[model samples]
Target chain A: MSVIKTFGKYRNLLGELVKKDIKLKYRNSYLGVIWTMLEPLLTMLVLTLVFSELLGKGTKDFPVYILTGRLLFSFYSNGTKAALKAVRNNAGMIKKVYVPKYMYPLASVLSGYVIFLISLVVLAVVAVVRGVYPTLQLFWIVVPLAQILLLTLGSGMLLSTMAVFFRDIEYLWGVALMLLMYTCAIFYKIDSVITGTNGWIFKYNPLYAIIVNFRNAVFGQAPDFQSMFYATAFGAVLMLFGTFVFYKQQDKFILYL
Target chain B: MSEMSAVTVQDLGVKFHLSEQKVDNLKEYVIRILKHQMRYKEFWALREVSFDIKKGERVAILGLNGAGKSTLLKVIAGVLKATEGKVTRSGVLVPLLELGAGFDQQYTGAENIYLYGAMLGYPKAFLREKFDEIVAFSELGEFIDVPVKNYSSGMRARLGFSIATLVEPEILILDEVLSVGDVKFRKKSENRIKEMFRQETTVLFVSHNLAQVRSLCTRALWLEKGRLVEDGPVEVVTEHFEKATTK
Candidate 1:
């Protein structure tokens, strides 16, 4: 109960931090927020050309598929990356002020989530261009959206805490994320590449589960309840575990910093 | 824990593990643990320290370098946790440990007011009401819109001081922040702190300036290498501290 009360008290600080992040992200850019909508659109175009034309793979709506997987993966990657550095980057403020330490990682993840949401507009446009329109299933997108957010928050908290103690985690995570991207099947269909029992390799990955469920919502298919349940449970458990570890180690952070 | 006490610190101790050789990365740390080479020397920054401050009293912490004065303030301000024992604070306490530490270099002075104010736990509506007052007090004038990276260190400190002092906290913790900006602004800040003193706010101040401590504090707590050596009236403690240090 007191935890909730503390969060309520610092809600405004969280808002300001999110705003500062988004503002600084586009500070000196000529096009500013226009880049948010443009970057994903261009990336979708490139991926679509590579997968559909040169490689002779994917359906006609492969562009939408790539955008869906790309955007979600980007958010997880970017959010966790920022959160990994959040505590160390704010060592000055941490030493001087008495804010709840979790606020730093929470703010970093939230700021990236905000930008990710804005970029979703690109997905919508590309989906329409490829003859895939919004359906009643679109509302079900919220499930996967929330799942990804929780998963990112969980990983972010855990990574940020580890990062304070071990600087090598930053470099290690970079290589890990690259490996994670390939496993997520961002460009290829999971069924086509991994057959038989090996399919569990992709199915077991929480991010892959989320991407599949999100694509279902985008393509007017019914939500995948099985994958949805698995991903949501995985995200929730990680989040709980992350919060536990973060709080346990937070008091010791000052000594390391 | 008395009704008259604004702050109570009981048997507070803070211990730090000093690694003989820095093992900052995970690989080195893992190898050291695996090889049974993990060695740690415990260093107590503050130990067996206890004190209570009555409401509205001004207390100065007097100590030499490495005497744990700053660590004591950090523990009291809740920035650092006590390794043993606890601190109980009854009112809204603000620690001005390092001004402008929260300011982002990319943000303008005006933007930083809201950012830093929010960081200090001020509500947005409250910051809006006091925005102009803060700008005027900072004397940044038109430079309020200029990015902090462009401001001189003095200007940044001036803006930080203005925002931090805007609200009269129930307990204000100051660590040598009175001497900010130029001579004129320093005097202005001192006067402003005096104004807060008139409101009967509790203050815990740490400074090397004995004369200033004598003027601002009614009582003093002198520390030596993490142990409290003297606690008495400001003048008496300062005299004793000076004589001992000069020997």
Candidate 2:
């Protein structure tokens, strides 16, 4: 609820750091900004070969499947990678500034969004080339994008702040993200997921609904309303908890830093 | 001392905790889920500290290293929350706790002034208009466009002191900032402090240099082992503090 104040207070700081992240990363690269596309494109190529050529036998629209999974991966993996180091990395800035401290995590979320924007453009161009026309339903992506952003923010907020107090949280988050890839429908369809008891685990994951909705919107399929609601509710709870921890311990950051 | 109490702190204290990083292993981190232990049985940083300063009273808090001077100043600034007691302030406070600690090293001196000004809650337009005055006060000359990391410690301190004094804070908190510059620049900072006092700004001065306090402050408090040992005329308290510590 206090997102306005939390966001507004650290906007400049976050904006500056995001600029630094982008600028610092691409400065020396030969490919430069193209790395954003090249990265996901390479992942899509590898997975498309293994999943589509080797195993996508009966599957229609294999490229869309791979593209959807790549989009989801771009957000979660890149988001968590930025988030895992967000606090430890910003030790210099955090020690001096009196910000909400969650701004560091929020910055990672925004950076991920920036990268996601790049991938979205790439996917759209490829989709057009493959004879998929833009649909009016495609406009509904704004909803899932906002939801996944909040969902990523919630998770990133928790990890980034905790990473300050407990340095090992970063490593743990790395492992968690690795395991989370399979849990989310990143490489395969959720319908092909395990049935019964084990299926409940995948069904409840926030990224599950997020990726499903994104695929649905961009591919003209209907979304899972129940899972989206679950993800939204859980994302809210995680965000609130993240904010609660951040606000409560925000001032103590000076001492820790 | 003036009639109005500009700042009051009653029985303030702070404690800290420490833990080994190994306790935060992956298995324990996951199992405990960061069930933090706030009490590691660490020593108290401050305990039962109390003092007050009236409007326009240049009260210096003098103490040795680790005497809780900085902690008390932080408590007053509200940068650090007190574990106990209340700090009542009559108006806005600008706590210059550590000179230049908040300035970015990569930014030029000019950019840092605005950044600090914004952090200190001064409007951008005000900083723009006051830009020359700040530059004149800093005396950094052509170096104003250079990053602070390239500046000497004295240059950094001068700019920090300049920006801090630029704001018209009703309560000014200075932590050993008087000795940062050359004799001429220090004199300038002293004059600025005098000007602030003239304007009814309550001054909470912290320093190891007793002479500055004797000249600038009317009342002085001596902190020993995080407790107020004496509070009175500047000369009397410094003498008492010197004698007690020298023993």
Candidate 3:
């Protein structure tokens, strides 16, 4: 009940912060928010050219497969990165104000999530061009979307807290994200390359699990409920743990800052 | 915890770790922990200081530099946590620690009013209703449409002061904010604060100017090196502070 009350009190502040982030993201750019749509489409085209045409890999409608993975991974990457810098970037305000410290990371991740949602229009356009039509299964996309959002928020909170104490976390996370991107199977088929025991690399990663479920929904196939349940549980547990750690260490943040 | 008290602080203490070599990286921290080489010099900014302010009391915190006056105000305003003891506040408290600290340079002065207001926990509708008043008080006029990055420091400070003083909070925390803008604007801002005093709002102020403190506050709390030296009527405490400083 107290949590709900706090949320109600800060809802307007959160909205303003998210709006500021989105507006500043493309402020000086020539095409502005148009980049949101064009970025994904251009990435899909480039990846298809390299993987399908040059490398002679992938099956039918490979562009659709790549688009789904790229969009989800980009959201996760961008959301967590924004969250990582949220606290330090707003150090001036943190030192002067009495706002809940968690609001910074929460707002940053949420702003990135909004931009990610907008970019999905490009995914839909590419899917139609690749002869993949939306069906009733698309309704299930909300499950994977929620799962990824929770995971990003959880990771963002944890990273933001750690980044305050250790500035190296910014550099470390950049390298770790590259490793995670490879493990997510964004442009590769797990069955074609790695078979048998080696498959656990992708299996154990919650982000990969979410991307698979998301692909299942977009490709008009029933999502794997068991995998969805596991991914959701993983995200929920991480989120709870992240929140606990963030709350405990938040008081010390001012001293460090 | 009196019913009439606006703020109650009990045995308040704040300790800061002054590390000889700042270990800001995870690897160094881990290595130090493993080698049992972790060392920190604990410096107490405030120790065993306690006070109570009743509603409508205007108290000036008088202290020399490095006297923990700002730390005490931060604790009362709920911006910093006390290392020991507790502070309880019963009303809406607004701390004007540094005005315009939350402004986004990329945004226009008009956009920043809402942003900074939101940061101060004011509702969007309230800002919209009083938008003209804030702009007029800021004297930004046509510059409201211009981005804040282009604003002069005085112009930025004026905008921040205008938005923050819009709502008459129950407890107003001021830290040298009255000295904002030009000489004329400073007088105007001080008058605005005097108006809030008329509303019976509790105020905790920190300033170096003894004349300003005597004119604006009824009581004074003097601190010397993180310890309270005196707490009494403004005239008596200021007199003591003046004598001690000259010696």
Comparing 1 with 2 on DockQ, the higher-scoring candidate is 1
State the lDDT of candidate 3 residue by residue for B1-247, as single tens digits: 9999999889989999998789999999999999988899999999989999999999999999999999999888777999998899898888888888888999999999998888888888988999999999999899999999999989999999999999999999999998899998998998999999999999999999999999999999999888888999999999999999989
TM-score of chain B of each: 0.98, 0.89, 0.97
Tens-digit per-residue lDDT, B119-158, candidate 1: 8888999999999999999999999999999999899999
* Candidate numbers, best lDDT first, in rank order: 1, 3, 2
Screening candidate 1 with a backbone cut-off below 3 angstroms (N, C-alpha, C), the clashing residue pairs are none
How many collisions per candidate?
0, 0, 0
Cα distance off (Å), candidate 2, residue A253: 4.1
Worst 10 residues of 3 chain B by lDDT: B93-102
State the lDDT of candidate 1 residue by residue for A1-257, as single tens digits.
29898888788999999999999999899999999889988888899898889999969899998999999999999999999999999998999898889999999999999999999988888889889999999999999999999999999999999999999999999999999999999998877887687887787999999999899999999988888999999999999999999999999999898
Name the 10 consecutive residues with the lowest summed lDDT in model 2 chain A: A92-101
Off by over 4 Å in 2: A1-38, A53-64, A81-98, A191-198, A251-255, B1-3, B18-39, B105-118, B122-151, B181-188
Off by over 4 Å in 3: none
lDDT leader: 1
Between candidates 1 and 2, the lDDT winner: 1
